[model samples]
Target: MDIETWMRGYETAWRSNDGDDIGTLFTDDAEYFTEPWTPPWRGRDEIVRRWVERADAPGDWTFSWHVVGVDAGTATAFVQGETCYAELATTYSNLWVIRFADGGRAASFTEWWMDQAHASDGDGDGEELG
Candidate 1:
């Protein structure tokens, strides 16, 4: 499946915050790693549950992404998101590596992200510190 098409479904799932919607993005035994070294949410059930537990409420965030590369069954992407909570707001960038199985679902997915420093008034966008 085309990466962008898959990502649109993912974005919709994120917006919906529905376990069933999220589950459709992965295989039965999919593995989702929040970070390169973090323990993964193993299986579709765990992935859906964990995502629901941590997801932003509907209409609380905006996401923009573009596929960086795709090779065989593996794909990579960069995503930027801004979350607006009642008392806190933040923006960050994420890099994802996903491996697709026979179907459009992902078998293994990994991500790396870092919070951008808060931008001061009139300071333009925040700088990313390594």
Candidate 2:
């Protein structure tokens, strides 16, 4: 599948928190890495379960992303999302690498994410961290 189609399905699944939706994004024996060095959630079932474990309930966050590049079977993208809870909000910056299988499902996927800077750091104004 093209990157746009695949990415739209991905975001839809994430926002819906549907197991079937999540499972459909991967191959039967897919691997998902939360970080480069961390052990992956191997296989579609495990990937779905682990992903659900970390899910944010529907309507909790908003995400926007753009494809960075695609080559052969692999594609990379940058995603930005903001989540709000208890009157506090946090923004996240994320990078994802996805290896698509022949059928358009992911054979392997990896993500790297970090929380964006807040407006204040306990003082009066927010300062860049050097």
Candidate 3:
């Protein structure tokens, strides 16, 4: 599967938070790691369940991403992204490592994210108070 198309589907699934939509992104035995060190949500069923449990409300966040690199031989792609949470006035920088299966579905996915520090002035501008 094309990496860009898969990423777009991921964004769609993120916004919708629908079980079916989320299910389509992974294989039956997919492993999803929310953080590099944390335990993964194994299998599509678990991933769907856990995802819905922590589902983000629609319109509450905006995300932008770009593919950083790809190893076609390994079926892996590296992605960088930024997520802005409107209500919290916070943003996070994310790096995702995705390994795709034979088809478009992901066989394994891992994410590393860090919250961007902002000034305390409550301006929501995402600027550091240097």
Candidate 4:
């Protein structure tokens, strides 16, 4: 699949809320950089473990259009989303840098965010870290 198509599949998978579907998107050795100093998480198993433990109601999370930029076999895109996870519902945005493998699994996915790329929940505030 093309970059756009692959990205669309990921967005669809997020909406589907099927753990398997989301889990299956990553390569076995996928490396995920959630944030600076967070230490990149290696292996899809670890990544999915954290995701499952962190997510609240599945439907509470979703991404808008992903504008992809293609360069060779790598792709970059910005994702806008809103999510309510357990105790927090907030507007968020991020840049996802991805590298596609030979068979199309995500060899790497680095999410670049600004303060979680979060805005207020509209009803209230995003929790302050300090």
Best model per TM-score:
3
- Per-candidate total of colliding backbone pairs: 0, 0, 0, 0
Sorted on lDDT, highest at the top, how do the candidates line up? 3, 2, 1, 4
Instruction: Report the lDDT tens digits of candidate 1 across residue range 3-120.
Output: 7777888988988988888999999999999999989999999999999989877777666777766776344444444433433566666778888877688888888775555334
Question: What's the distance in Å from true for residue 57, model 1?
Answer: 0.8
Writing each residue's lDDT as its tens digit, candidate 2 over 1-130 gives 4768888888889888899999989999999999978999999999999889999777776777777767763444334333334234667677888888887888888887766653335565656454
Q: Give model 3's TM-score versus the native structure.
A: 0.89
Top lDDT model: 3
**Tens digit per residue, CA lDDT, model 3, 52-103:** 9999999999999998999999999999999999899999999999999998
lDDT of model 2 at position 15: 89
Clash pairs for candidate 2:
none
- Hey, what RMSD does candidate 2 come out at? 4.9
TM-score of 4: 0.67
Model 2 ranges with Cα > 4 A deviation:
73-87, 118-130
Model with the higher lDDT, candidate 2 or 3: 3
Between which residue pairs do clashes occur in model 3? none
Spell out the clash pairs found in candidate 4: none
How many Å off is the CA of 124 in candidate 3? Answer: 28
